[model samples]
Target: MIPSAFDYAAPATVAEALSVLADAGDDVKLLAGGQSLIPVMKLRLADPAMVVDLGRIGELSGVRDDGDALLIGAMTTHHQIATDPLIAEHVPLLAKAAATVADPQVRHRGTFGGALVHADPAGDMPAPVLAADAAFILAGPEGERRVAAADFFQGYFTTAVDDGEILTHIRVPKYTGWGAHYEKFTRVAQQWSIVAVAVMVRVEGGTIAEARIGLTNMASTPLRATAVEQALVGAALTREAIASASAHAAEGTDPASDLNGDAAYRRHLAEVLTKRAVIAAAGL
Candidate 1:
């Protein structure tokens, strides 16, 4: 299907982009990497009156250190994040998740912020970002405001990014030296995750010092597995301990029944994947 014709604007700066976005009303769409939006547009799932390309905005791409955290520009490609030394060292969970996003070509062009703002419950980025406690920076007509991951995602295919707002940057607190992993299950290659678990743990003296868990495709939005995290803390870093903690993985989830699997199956997968993810993340 051919999408409806639309006017296009390539803005070199955030302020210029915001101006066009503000003026274009509800029929405007922002292009960032074009991995998700382009496909939908091609399918006629989305037909905007105007497209504002943010690709020329140089400030919205790259990784930088911001004291205790890392600042990742919204337009930074998944390929860059997957291989960036800063991300690898401080937030390996994100690197791992980014590397698994729809294979090489898509990874090369998909932007992290674009994925988050798309807010697909099955997306690889959201779970890990939630687990890392990342914050999103939004640029809008009223100026900038930061939104926490917990509040950023409103529902399936929805986010805190309003019509006139653009996500400009992401702040990920350093999880340096932590062992982390993203475990995902799909029906076929490059398929959306039926269920996935993102885990990051700090182990000290053979005990879990801290643990963070995020579940993908477990609800209307990415969910923090707080029960699993709480269970893992102070427990020994062993398969037995992880399995025990993982039993609580589905305690607060609302997985959907679909062709790939039923809700019960996803609940079971969450538990099993949580154990595998925790063990791998703990380097056991």
Candidate 2:
């Protein structure tokens, strides 16, 4: 299956990319790592009139310090995020999640922003990014706009990135010293998660000072385990406490039934995985 013929532009700057997208009207797709779009294009699932490739934009491929947060360029690959020193020290949860995405080749080619924009509920990055409370930066002809992760993912395979806009960077606040873990279940490695949990916990003197939890494949979009997070805060770093909080993992999610498993099964997995993820994150 070959993609339908389309005009292509490899832009050297975000401004140039945006210009290409704008001039191409509403039928253009932006290519980052080409991990997601390329496959769909091959299947003709998405037949755009043009593809504005952002790979040539040098500025959109690195990490930068920004006081309380880090600015991760949209074109940064999953492998880079998983191994970068800044990400490992300041946002270990992101690195943990990135490392679990597919295999070596996919990780080397999949872009963080591309994964987030793809917004697949089964994808590994969104839940962790949401749990981290990250922000997305969108570049458009009108200029740039910032959107929180919670608002960024609107539904399965959909996001706040409007027509003619390109996700430029991710703003991740420092979660330094927090324990982080990504627990995923699949029939095998490198498959889309059947159900996954991403957890970050801040412990103080053996007490859970704070916690952030995110769920994958539990809804149309990656979901924050808010109920579980609230329940864990100020609790003792004990298995019993984690088990109690984990029970709330499926309280507010509407999981879809698919070939992988039924919705009820996913809900069950959510509770089980959340506990395991939280325990691992707490290092207990």
Candidate 3:
């Protein structure tokens, strides 16, 4: 199957890309790495009349440390994030997840922003981004606006990005004292996760001070396991406590049923994986 005929425009500047999108309106799609969009287009799931390619926009492709946060440009490739020394030291959770996304060939061409914007429930990036409490920088004709990771994803394959808006960068807070781990359960080496858990634990004096748990393929959007987080706070950083808290992973989630796993099966995997992730993150 081939994608429908469309007008292709590669803009050298962000302003030009935005102009193309604004003029093309809903009929236009922003092309970043095109790993996700191109497949959908070929399958005839998406039929945009125009594609505003951002590959030529040099400003949207770098990684930098911004004060207390790590700013990753939207166009940065997954392979770049996986191998970056700064990312490995500052946000190992992201680097770990990036390494598990698809295969090396896909990672070579896939963009972080493209994956996040695609908002697939099983995609690996969203869970870690949620656990990191990242923020997205969106640019449009009106200017730039910052959106939290929690609010940026509205539903499956849907985002809070309005028409004509382009996600330019992602700002992830530096979790200096936090121990992070990403545990993914997949059927094959390069397959999407059947269920994945991203855990970030702040341990103070052998006690759990703060915890954030994000679930992938457990709901319409990447869901924060708030119930589990609430249960872990102030608890002793031990395997028993982590197991007990992780039992609540499915307490508030509404996982979908699919070929990989049924809703109940996913709920079970969520609990099991979350426990393992939290224990590992807590060094238990």
Candidate 4:
């Protein structure tokens, strides 16, 4: 099936794109790489009256280091992020997750911000972004606003982005000297995660000093396994401790029962995958 008839406009600048979105209101959708939106449109799941393409908006497509954080433009492709030296240096967990997103063709066409804003619970980046505690810069007619990654995603396929607002950039904190890992459990090479875990740990003198564990597809939104984090604090890096912490992966999550797996199965996956992610992140 083809998308419904719509007006298309490729804006050369972000301002122009915002203007189009502001004028079109909710009837419009901002098109980034269109890897996610185009397929949804083709299926008639989304039929916006107008598409404000941001592909030509140069300002929304680059990777830069800004002191303590990496400023990634909203339109930066997964392919770019996966291979970017800056991202690899500062946020290897993100690069690892980006490389696992779908296949090469999809990665080439998918944008980081598009995947986040699309807010698919099964997508790889959301958990890592949340684990990294990234912030989003949103631009609209009223100017700009900053939103924390924790607050950016409201639900499955829902976000804090208001009507007419476009996500301009994502600010990821530099993770220097941090040991991070992204562990995903999927049926196939490029399949969406049945349950994925993103772990970032700061080890001090062979003890877990700070740890953040994020769960993907474990709830309506990407969730931080605070229980696991609490369990790991000051704990010796041991299999027993990691397993104890990971056992709480499904403690507070409300996972869906779908074709992928049942709630019980997801809980088990969460526990197993979280342990693996924690072990890898801790270099144990």
Number of the top lDDT candidate: 1
Candidate 3 residue lDDT tens string, 1-284:
99999999999998988888878868888898899899999999999999888999888987899999899999999999899887887888898889889999999999999999999999999999998999999999999999999899999899999998999999998887688899999887888899999988999987899998889998889999999999999998788888898899998888888888799999999999999999888887
Instruction: Please give, for residues 16-103, the per-residue lDDT of candidate 2 as tens digits.
Output: 8877777898888988889999999999999999988888999999998999999999999999999999999999999999999999
**Per-residue lDDT for 21-122 in model 1, tens only?**
888899989999899999899999999999999999999999999989999999999999999999999999999999999989999988999999999999
Model 1 TM-score is: 0.99
Give me the runs in candidate 2 sitting further than 4 Å from their true place. Answer: none
- In model 1, residue pairs whose N, Cα or C atoms come closer than 3 Å (at least 3 residues apart or on different chains), thus clashing, are none
- In model 3, the worst 10-residue window by lDDT is 84-93
Clashes of 1: 0
Task: Name the regions of candidate 4 deviating beyond 4 angstroms.
Answer: none
* Better candidate number, 3 or 4, judged by TM-score: 4
Ranking by TM-score: 1, 2, 4, 3
lDDT of each: 0.94, 0.93, 0.91, 0.91
For candidate 1, the lDDT comes to 0.94
Superposition TM-score, candidate 4 onto the true structure: 0.97
